[model samples]
Target: MHYSLPLALALGLLLVACQSAPSDTSTSAEAMADATPGAAYQLVWSDEFDGEHLDTTKWNYNVGGHGWGNNELQFYTDARPENARLAGGTLRITAIHEPWEGKEFTSARLTTKGKADWTYGRFEIRAKLPSGVGTWPAIWLLYTDKEYGNQGWPDNGEIDIMEEVGYDPDVIHSTIHDKAFNHSIGTQVGDTLRIPTARSAFHVYRTDWTPDSIISYIDDQRYFAFGNTGEGWEEWPFDHDHHLLLNVAVGGNWGGQQGVDTTAFPTAMEVDYVRVYQQK
Candidate 1:
């Protein structure tokens, strides 16, 4: 199904909200050597996304249009090797403007569902985004429970570790959604970080989620923090466990403004690694 232009644009922004910079001074290898060590924490789980294929043992695809909570256009398919792949030390999810299974857009959504879940910890991802007027790439987390005890949606809570819009290349957003506030209506407490060359170089997006607070960081620089208020679920829905999700979507409510740049077909959001750590 083709999504309406307005809806596609809105979905593009919202999907990414639940969520850069490159310097030519050094090579990737050189930068790696000079990289500041991340704060030491016990490693709990990680996927380097190495090898030639996605490790099915760790991730599951969301598959087909489940509405994706945002009227997204793509069909999310599982076990479709075309949707998810590991190559050259990175996991690549490409969004294409094409017809697939009754849908106009075909893309992949991968998550560490049953394989892993965490309540409080530091989660990090090193990624390079895909660029184009209609590309939407995101790295975020969601609660594992089927429902937040009937509270539903934002009440159940959602954490967007990193979300970037193709049109806004320099900004990366991090946000939390709860019953009292949601992104759909523009009621969310979040922050944006600026990256000069996010689409060209890899940068780390991270979140330190604790019992008392949720802190978002970009390459270790903390930009946003939300604390648990006494207001219960209405204010804070993050006391429970959540799993990770990574995907690249094209031409949704938010992504199709300039229309699909068919020339940029097969664009990819490349992830170098995804790691989770717990306090010792």
Candidate 2:
């Protein structure tokens, strides 16, 4: 997901070489059905990223500076084909360890930002995670504003729909952070589901957000849920509308535990499609 300088140059050259290479372009509305084999759902907004380039209207990258919460090492960019691309009907967000504006890693952080913001709905992403050490791939949601009460972080709340570290290939985590709990202090409460085939194959990571509770599902199996207790910000700040974020981070405090794997330089999180469904 994230990389170093020499690796970045190598990946850039590799991408350039791959640009003219042939890819499988056949795509149908039935890709998900075929992958899941008997899942039932209606698609509202869906993008397979089927063209030769990124879809500017649907996604925008979050460029510049270290992220507020995590001391991540990549700068998100906007409209840069290097950060994102549509190849073989899949959206590839590659992370490389190259210097950019003083940061060592440059990767893509794409979001629905201005295009989509949902209060409560079913969000699903069919993706194949990046492999090797130091990669941190996440599918999460954030509030549209930065108002977080007296306290910053957890006061505003954060819903980690799904987060997976490269070191732990079989386990996926889902959590909710608020003033009362977060990952830093180890007070964060959530569940982990083990999917041994996660990195090797494409799987649907879904979250059903409703007024009463939030449910996380991997494939068709629901694994975790958090409810709004009507207590205070400690219980829920998710009542407001939030947008989606999909990124592959590298060499962060949590991600770089075992250090980087140079061989996996140009690692990528391939998104087959992203679909949002509302109650009919």
lDDT per residue as tens, model 2, 55-111 = 778777787756535667677766666767888999888887677888777788888
TM-scores for every candidate against the unseen true structure: 0.82, 0.80
Model 1 poorest 10 in a row by lDDT: 20-29
| Candidate 2 Cα errors over 4 Å, as ranges | 1-42, 146-152, 184-186
| Best prediction by lDDT | 1
lDDT against the true structure, per candidate, is 0.72, 0.70
> lDDT by residue for model 1 over 94-142, one digit each (tens)?
8776788888777898888788988888899999998877777889888
TM-score of 2: 0.80
Residue 85 in model 2: shift from native, Å?
0.4
Q: Of the candidates shown, which would achieve the greatest TM-score relative to the real structure?
A: 1
Cα RMSD to the true fold for all candidates:
8.7, 12.9
Give the Å shift of residue 186 in candidate 1. Answer: 4.6
